[model samples]
Target: MVKVTFIEHDGKEHEIEAQEGLTLMEVAVKNGVPGIDADCGGACACATCHVYVDEGFKEATGEASPMEESMLDFASERQDNSRLSCQISVSKKLEGMKVKIPEFQG
Candidate 1:
């Protein structure tokens, strides 16, 4: 399992352990992480699962694909580090991954 930390708008941190091969969005929604509302599952279509990845976990998680990039354009609070959580595949390298949920992700 891998550890995922989600930072909420009110400065709260929610941590959960996810099985390998599960996407970040899967972990969030399955565990009711609140901020990540993955409307399109892992299709990379809806941007509701948006999150800002911390710089420490960026290289391990890697950049979003062009498909994800295109979808991000529709996110509510697009930012320099904005990413669709569904695009992130869980791996040992991402054990301590931390992501910040935008205040207005609906």
Candidate 2:
């Protein structure tokens, strides 16, 4: 399991263990982490799961796909580390990855 930490815009920290192969958005929504709407489920069509990957964890999480990268532009808070949590899968590689709920997601 991967322990994903979500640091909200207001500075609240929420951590949860995500099962391998599930999307980050799935873990957040299923566990009621708040801020991630995931309105389109795991589809890349919606930007409701938009989040900012903590710079320290960005390289480890790797870059977002071109499609996910493009959809992030539609999000309200587009940061250099902006990503759609739905597009990120969970694994040992991302065990302690940190993501911040964007100001717009709330």
Candidate 3:
């Protein structure tokens, strides 16, 4: 399992052991982590599953696809580190990764 940390807007942290081949949004939703609404499931059609990838993990999380980039335009509190969690797939290289959930989904 890959370990991932989710930091809520209120500064709450949820450390989850996620299965490989699953998206970060899947781990968030399955583990009941708050602030990751994932309204469009893992389709990358919505930005409700938005998160800010920790700078250190940016390389592992990688850049967003065009479709994901378009969807992120709808997210609130967008940042340089912003990414749609649904677009991030879990993998060994992503172990110990951290993401911060926005205060609102927009």
- For all predicted structures, in order, the TM-scores are 0.93, 0.91, 0.97
In order of listing, the candidates' clash counts read 0, 0, 0
lDDT of 1 by residue, 1-95 (tens): 88888888888988889899998888998888877878777788788899998888888888889998999889887888888889989899988
Model 1 TM-score is 0.93
What is the Cα-based lDDT of residue 44 in candidate 1? 84
Ranking by lDDT: 3, 1, 2
C-alpha positional error of residue 30 in candidate 3 after TM-score superposition, expressed in Å: 0.3
Shift of residue 50 alpha carbon in model 3, Å: 0.3
Candidate 2 displacement at residue 1 in angstroms: 1.6
Reference-based lDDT, residue 104, model 1: 76
RMSD of 1: 1.1
State residue 37's C-alpha deviation in candidate 2, in Å. 0.6
* lDDT tens per residue, model 3, 1-106: 9999999989999999999999999999999999999887888888999999999999998888999889989999999999999899999999999899999995
Q: Give the range where candidate 3 is weakest over 10 consecutive residues by summed lDDT.
A: 37-46
Residue pairs that clash (backbone atoms under 3 angstroms), model 2: none
User: Which parts of model 2 are misplaced by more than 4 Å?
Assistant: none
Ranking by TM-score: 3, 1, 2
Please report the candidate that would top TM-score against the real structure: 3
